[model samples]
Target: MSSLNTNTNIKSEIDIRKKANYKTEGSDNIRTKKQKKYVLIDGHVYDFLKRSFDIIFAIMFLMIASPVMLVVAFLIKLEDGGPIVHARICIGKNNREYKMYKFRSMIPNADQMFQLFTPEQMERYKVGAKFDDDPRLTRVGKFIRRISIDELPQLFSVVRNDMSVIGPRPVIEREAAAYGENRNKLLSVKPGITGWWQVNGRSDCAYLSDEAKNLQLYYVDHRSMGLDIKILLKTFKVVFYGKGAR
Candidate 1:
């Protein structure tokens, strides 16, 4: 499970992905829907039905969560008078970059405060790309994070067509290099707010480790509308139980 070969073209890439899938799962487990969806067009497998579902799901979630988002926004602002939404460039389909949004769950200028962390904490942060006991989190931030409320702002990204409702979670641009040859395959489809790895273990899986990499790759290789629906249903239970959240 090292990086894929660098010389692979679009068809070859798809072939390699299919071959990888076959090795990972028995042929009997291979779903035709997954195979049909990845015939690349201009370096992407456009699934209009999935995009349509994303649009509909985004609209419905927005409609249902608008009032709750407003309340969360007001509380965030009231706590420290800081920006309610945090935006950062995240890599999306075909290596395109877009601003991904989330509620600001940390103090303003938290990046600057990273220097204050102890060396051990900084080492952990570098390894995992997240802090198990983050000191920058605001009081309201801690609460919102525990219940997974901080991600509601990303519904806007979904509506804006920057992400799908169910797919691989987008990664920051700096983190994209780690994918190496798999980068193109990873970016061949739209990134999502939730997906297989997320529903399976969320933050518990070490970033860039085999567990995380394999899960993400498995999702990309074996993706289908049916798989997406299954992941979505599992996501609800994960959310309700607050499973694997930081």
Candidate 2:
């Protein structure tokens, strides 16, 4: 009888221990969920402010840049009698695809011209989806891209809520694939016109490279109003100096 009692006590003790561990694990999971919820709530205010600023800034800048945009449009049309705006499908927040607009900075049907690239040019294009001296650029294309005037039309995208003023620059589908498992994280926030990557080194840091990936991920993880302001200031400097404009 005593042995049976002892066995019963051991069984009870084991049952108690199992319950304790289960409770601990359950509580841990609840805590993790709560923490994630808190982060989302905390970022809500920041997102609101950022969106407000994007609209105001884009609208104001668009008004100021209207004359320049008209001149660019005229020049592009006169140069080749082709479309003045280039619309590209880029991956945006939450893996949503959107059309991103830029002033036409390349000849008409430039995408079809890729097959004509020389081996060296093709290799360089594979590195960053850009050419150091692309033959596809029109005379005016070269000038506008050099000064980043080509990017002005993206203000319309910002106003449309398709992009942010300071975030990772939107990537084409092929470029987005390079993010691999981290693609969701990269697309967790809206892509930007000028970003940490733009101000850091632009084309010098190849989009396919690990350095570029880390820099872009760093921005996504650490973005805030202060960081946005710093990026904006640096962007002006970069534009004026034409740093890494290739």
Candidate 3:
């Protein structure tokens, strides 16, 4: 009986040692992976060229779009005598926070009036991050939103270096939680005015939904100057066709 007990003790010690070794190896593997590095592009040249492109095109677009922006601004103020733009605080590259520029498509007190929505409307807004029949929209707001003219002002962000001309869409800070382990990867490059997710399906895929995160992260992983150009061209089509603006 003593021999059996000794054997059982020995077996227990062996099992414990095996588990300890396994845990050590597991931790080592994770540490090794964490130490390895990845990069978005091959060289500094790509980054420089991308930034140059953003700057040049941002200037051009702003010059050309300024008149339209002014007209829209006038219409917004004429409607309700409210603010003309909405500078939403959003997450940018390296987890930097910046105010993303957009033409105002809601009433000036829109953020303060959430409780005015019906529970059903609030739920719908939460699901899509925008309400199709949002009460905050002024008459001018509906037109601009439907045609996506509201986002034209984001050229200012590109010019200001807060965003890229083409990359992943900037996300609200709270939405960062949904990226999970990929948050660092997503924030490695400047967010864009247009991107893979926008060209594929804008608000059709609700913000932070699995589908939206997958599309955004896919762009982050496989981004290139060539891909950016493709997205820019495709974005024109999506915008002109009013494919998924709502």
**Top candidate (TM-score):** 2
Candidate 1 lDDT tens digits, 1-246? 123445446669889899988877775446554565445542243477788888898889889998999999999999999999999999999889999999999999998898778888888677664554788899989888878899988888998898998888788875677788888888987788899989986887766776787788889999987898999999899989988776
lDDT of each: 0.83, 0.92, 0.86
39-77 per-residue lDDT for model 3 (tens digits): 333446678899999999999988998898999999998
- Output the number of the lDDT-best candidate: 2
RMSD of each: 15.1, 5.4, 10.5
Cα displacement (Å) at residue 102, model 3? 1.0
Candidate 1 local lDDT, residue 153: 82
Better of 1 and 3 by TM-score: 3
TM for every model, in the order presented, reads: 0.80, 0.83, 0.81
RMSD of 1: 15.1
List runs of model 1 lying over 4 Å from the truth.
1-46
Candidate 2 TM-score versus the reference: 0.83
Report how far residue 210 has shifted in candidate 1, in Å.
2.1
Lowest-sum lDDT 10-residue window in model 1:
37-46
